[model samples]
Target: MPYYCDLGPGQKVYLDNPGPTTLITLASGSAGQQQQSSTQIHTGPWTEVPQIARVGSGALLRCVTAQGTYTWQIQGMQIGAAPTNAWVADQATPMQATEVGLSSMASMQPMAPMEPMAPMRMGDMQMSMNPMTMRMGNMTLGLDAPAASTQQFCTQCGAAIAWGDRFCGSCGHQLHQP
Candidate 1:
């Protein structure tokens, strides 16, 4: 399905697709200068803009499936504004049908503007104890939790150390437990 999110001033859209491939496009301004990226959806989340990128008002995120049928979800967060709007679009017809020039393919039709639903506060979202499950609108994304840290940095010489080390490997400084 194709999805759209209005990222108001200082706002950004976050997408997490734990499986399948997706194409993300960003359009801004009246001229519709666009930037696009194709990403393989692994177990980690990805964003349309860099975490540090400055997002202005009216930024739009357009996402479409690259292949296969898959469940997808996305959420928007404003830098200093609260989360309020959630939009969901109907499932997009598979690329195969559209590419073949099937006369019956609905994907060729222009998408209607999505009506804004009731606002969802950030606090109203549910988070499970297991990090994998995330709910965005009506879709649930299962993501692999990032691995826990098993390494530490040595204070004396700034060398890398395994979690249980008792001495600094580079400078021989005694390691103290905090």
Candidate 2:
């Protein structure tokens, strides 16, 4: 978009988009009449007048130069990255119900109905949580508990055994399967 500068009553000079690094031109009407650049408006090697204040987006900038006084309006293509007051929605494109190799029904398969998960039942479960202290610089944080051993032991000899073991390792005791 172009920037409009008010020269006087019933007069406007269109300037090329006002970006800092871009070479600003006096867009169609004022072309070749006066030589001006974005650097001249922003940084200013102006003949007499320099920039007055930090130019706001969509705000009028009043400045004077060898050409004349100009009331340049900052509209489109701002000096830097600025937020626009427009809202845009993101939407997905609709896909066709047919594939190159597969049949049309293959792309439109019936979804499986979801069922409720079975409720978990824990009978006589014993747990002990051990929190560990972690130190980083001056911040100290507590870590998650380490898992406690739930290994099965032989009742007669009190020897550690696998859950489905028929006999204990330490003593050759036969284990009763529950």
Candidate 3:
């Protein structure tokens, strides 16, 4: 069963119910926003009560039924307002701290901060400078071009091709221009 405590300056409340209970409060303010006193609850009862069902925006309060789960958010408080029924029962990826140097993080629409990665060695890393040639190890790649004399322009991607190079180093286009 769950009960409400008069939240004094630093009072606390805990909820451990066999079935779910709803948390209703006196009208502290308007809808979608309310202010109240501060209270803390430490959930106890289930080893992993991994399901959450939201009755209302302000009604569904996660009664702290265990230690270390500080999830009983106060109503009208937008600090940690999680989506309704989004408890940890679904076995989804936990939101980890964002990293710093990940290439995939750069392409995110709203980029999140990345976690710092250890420095990578050249032998353990494989990256692509362009799209055609994937770099394997520490080596310079050369392409076939004109006979080391005639100026050649890349037919594709509009890049200049060096003499004796078979491919455009910049755009990876065929450099053997006539």
Q: Per-residue alpha-carbon lDDT of model 1 for 73-136, expressed as tens digits?
A: 3323212221223211332221111122212121235555666544334654654433456676
Q: Model 3 RMSD to the real structure?
A: 17.2
Which stretches of candidate 3 lie above 4 Å from their native place?
1-40, 44-46, 63-74, 78-178
Q: How many backbone clashes are present in model 3?
A: 17
lDDT of 1 at 171: 94
lDDT of 2 by residue, 1-178 (tens): 3334443333333332223312222222243453222323442223322221223323334333444444433444333222322211121111122122221112335655656433332343322225455444555566564544557889889988876888988888888867
What's the lDDT for all of these models?
0.39, 0.39, 0.39
TM-score of 2: 0.19
Each candidate's clash count: 1, 0, 17
Clashing pairs in 2: none
lDDT of 1 at 98: 15
Looking at candidate 2, the ten consecutive residues that score lowest on lDDT are 87-96
- Scanning candidate 3 in windows of ten residues, the lowest lDDT window is 97-106
After TM-score superposition, the amount by which residue 108's alpha carbon in candidate 2 deviates from its true location, in angstroms, is 43
Number of clashes in model 2? 0
